[model samples]
Target: MTEFAPDAGFRKNRKLKDALLQHKALSKDGLSERLFSLLFSGLVYPQIWEDPDVDMEAMELQPHHRIVTIGSGGCNMLAYLSRHPSSIDVVDLNPHHVALNRLKLAAFRLLPVHADLVRFFATPKLSSNSAAFDRFIAPELDVSTAAYWNGRDLYGRRRITVFNRNIYETGLLGRFIGAAHLLARLHGVRLQRITEARTLREQRRFFEEEIAPIFDRPVVRWLLSRKSSLFGLGIPPQQYDELASLAGGGSITQVLKQRLEKLACHFPLQDNYFAWQAFARRYPDAGEGPLPTYLRPEHYPAIRANAGRVTVHHASFTELLAAEPAASRDRYVLLDAQDWMTDEQLNALWGEISRTARPGARVIFRTAAEKSIIEGRLSPALRAQWHYDEERSQALNVRDRSAIYGGFHIYGKAA
Candidate 1:
């Protein structure tokens, strides 16, 4: 377990920092260690990478289901609330993430209406969001979480002031994407032009002419080759190994190019806000672009109605599950966190998952590789208790608009 400084945000995650260091591909490299330290020092995800639409289709969350998910950007968990789940437990190793989730819940409950919430999140340049926070949501947050957003940065400005800017461009991933845009400019490519393409052919043309060549640049490939360089993507060192193996002849740059292309060219720009955020550093529109389900206007009422159902905490999956009674949880959204675990960690996690999972409960996760990490890793007894939904996983992976992962996997507890 990590000890967090109540007002320190993510920089206080001692355990997570130690874990990532141990798993680092180049553990002895002082440079990698330092980069990992800095990367984990703040919120890594302003938007989650997993596609909740595909996840929702796979889980088929009933009104009775109890959902547990890794609270990345807290988007998908809020998205799940629209299904009217009985309860949702969202945990994160990063305190900043837990604070972010709590802040979202508070905003949903405190804001006058969905429009105010949208303006708070979607319209980043508005000063009204900060005012809304002070007037409505501030009184509702826990002491620690409120302190996080209220604390001033080195620049002597309130951290919450980011809401007055483009809040989506406010995290490690956001800065990474912004850096990518700068790099593209250096290569004489306007990455945003891909968003202008009206058809798949035009998208592909933009990629080949603008994006693909950026990947070929010497500096780009050099940076991509370093595992530390990818920490901004929320990829840990161990997952870097998996991505390397799957990158077609050990070229991780090639793998990133393929994934980026999938995000940019395989889906229509109007429909894939993931692409828009990646290139443009903000959604295509303030309230009209393809937004996350939780951020959309129609889903806002349901989210507010059920926002109280979510309980955010800072803990590991196994630790959280072990605290619950057997057959207590029904749906699991692990994201790609398992890729950072050891074989022993994998077995232990599955062991706890199998124990806590209700009969017919579904466990869904993404892998940096196209295969689930369960095979040949867990005891046969433990593995037999769950059945893999291979066909459905494959189908859903294709439908995943995020298109950032190699595979989407689902496992169901045998009835």
Candidate 2:
């Protein structure tokens, strides 16, 4: 099977470089940034980590609304279609993600049935997936997108072969979870044990007895201290600092443990697919546990019917928004992209968002730390155009099934 060369044209991507490169080339921080950029240059998120249910609730998505969002892993974009939004413009700096988003859209449109789409995306080790992609998905793809899947890696196999294996286990986030599982196993802790708990009580017991102890290990603490160790989580150095700050002068491992505990205990395993991916590696077998909204059999019809409403772009969110007319878009989903931006970038992003926002337009994003990162960052005038719903944002943050992010924020364009 072909492995993706994640950094095929990484150096030439100025936007990515601008977002990631912050320190001198020979500096310690600089190397970590470069390394993360390289890994991120390929497929980082096989599945987006943010919970779309929480996102939909926060944004109050409507059928007449036009949505613009950062297209990470593309699941949420499809998930949003359940609300029947008029259109979704998805932008990303990584071409691999753009290609993946397009591939998912094509799969939804052309696959013969819901089960066929499931087999192609969710089933692992299915040898016929590549054949299905070739026959159904490839012919309809635009030239560049077709070239992306047809393109070969260092090994002499097409990129589409990733479908035949576990697509969830192939990207940077997948590898990170895989490594975490391995590390847990090495310490005689099976993280998957948490998934076996049928009740929240059992979940907490499993976390306390089995998973929590691993954080106290000297090696585990040392590993957590290194910013490079988290690159697989798609966390750049800037975001890592925010996560560390959340530790509040305590061990970063404690923060990780708390987040993991929430993931294990806050939601029932049967209802949270994010927990399944974290512990079980693949999504639950059909009808056994929850899947992302886009992958649920019931949501399939709606997503397929509305798949054409999405347009995928290989550009930054701010750049894409900059091209739109004023007061044109009604919803924005930034994911956690802002956690990586500089103050100047944040101002530029809000400037465009404020300009393009329709009346009552809502914006939702996540943060690495438990507070809104935009406070005092956006220029005062730009900030005044929006109202931050502090109580609602905090309420929703606890409800985010992903449990990886510290804050889930909601802002509304001031009427």
Cα RMSD (angstroms) for every candidate in the order listed: 2.9, 1.6
Please, what are the lDDT tens digits per residue for candidate 2 over residues 51-72? 9999999988889999999988
The residue pairs in collision within model 1 are none
Query: How big is the positional error of residue 36 in model 1, measured in Å on the Cα after superposition?
Result: 1.7
> Candidate 2: lDDT of 244?
87
Q: What is model 1's C-alpha RMSD?
A: 2.9
lDDT of 1 by residue, 37-133 (tens): 6667677787788888888999999999999899989989999988999999998887778878899999999999888877887776898778889
Give residue 133's lDDT in candidate 1 (0 to 100).
Answer: 92
TM-score of 2: 0.97
